[model samples]
Target: MARERLEIEAPEVAVHLDAQDPESLRRLVLEACQRASTVRTDHEPLVDLALSQLVRGTPDDNLARKLEELAERTDDRYLTAQEAADPNWATLFRSARLASALSLALREQTRSSVLNSIYEAAHASPDTAAFYRDLLL
Candidate 1:
């Protein structure tokens, strides 16, 4: 057997590392935030599909009922976990408004608790960010 070594490059991180100007760095960071938002919603469709199945299911009789009961229990647990991970509307709206208002400040490299929260919420759900972004505009 021969030994082999491989090197992997993280293209995303490289974008930030290669930035030579403040504006470029800010653009890269904003792009990263948007990418994070998209990644967070990747699992949402699967969860939605599961919920739809539960809602559309029909029980033929006792055996079907039993199977559905088991499914419901599992689905309930999954939904509960998903809910826990999701940011509430209030937080999402506030964050989007603040982030939008402070867009220049973000570029200027200012950090605050509110900004941090907004970034967190935005990464949790891109749709929430877009909702409030449009609402604020």
Candidate 2:
């Protein structure tokens, strides 16, 4: 079944998310977060939008690892988006990346409306959810 496109639009930006390939979907999520962050320095909204849309698309182990790696990079100032000419954009990227990593890690346990969409895609069961929950902490 084809996943429905989740359209996120702001005055200067419009992102369409419906890619079937996990890698493409991950790229799209990052692109969307980058674009949204450029428009607004605040990270939560953009990260939430990208992650919510990402869960609706597809899931891949490599993509999950990429998200985790992104989160880890935030600890290194030189490796983070913060070092870019546009420091605000880098901050946005770092924040969004962290949020994405958490979302992927707690995929089965998160209950937010956006996070729930990912559970649907994965069809995670109670045991799976419990496993994720155990890892929480």
Candidate 3:
């Protein structure tokens, strides 16, 4: 009887990083952010599809229901945590939470377009436009 020895070799991997180059660093950061966003939404295919329809201003009952559920859950959690002590703080917190939820729901470009449309609508009303402009300034 004879015994033979088996050997395994690990594969080599290469990563390039140019710390001093601003453009390279910017590209790296952008790629990382894009990957992170994709991974964040990859687990929910139905939600992503529904949200894509929403981005196009399409009405979806499923999406609406999901959003309603999300809002209810968020409100419940906020109350459970007892973070609604101060009126001002509660309003700010809820607004910020809603904005964060929107960010997660829509893609970057769609979010920008939606927000821009909202701004435009605000400006379309002469009375409110002036107030909006004042707030911005």
Which residue runs of candidate 1 sit more than 4 Å off their true CA positions?
1-19, 41-137
lDDT of 1 at 131: 35
User: What C-alpha lDDT do the candidate models reach, one value each?
Assistant: 0.35, 0.38, 0.35
RMSD of 2: 15.5
Runs of candidate 3 exceeding 4 Å displacement: 1-51, 83-137
Q: What tens-digit string does per-residue lDDT give for candidate 3 at 1-137?
A: 42111001101100122122434433332332222223222125543554455345444455545544654564565565566465444433343234233333332333233333233223223343352333233
What CA root-mean-square deviation does each model show from the true structure? 19.6, 15.5, 22.8
Q: Would you estimate the TM-scores of all the predictions? A: 0.23, 0.29, 0.31
Q: Order the candidates by TM-score, highest first.
A: 3, 2, 1
lDDT of 1 by residue, 8-103 (tens): 122223332344354544443344334333332223443233323323332123433333343344445545655778544433333333333223
In model 3, residue pairs whose N, Cα or C atoms come closer than 3 Å (at least 3 residues apart or on different chains), thus clashing, are none
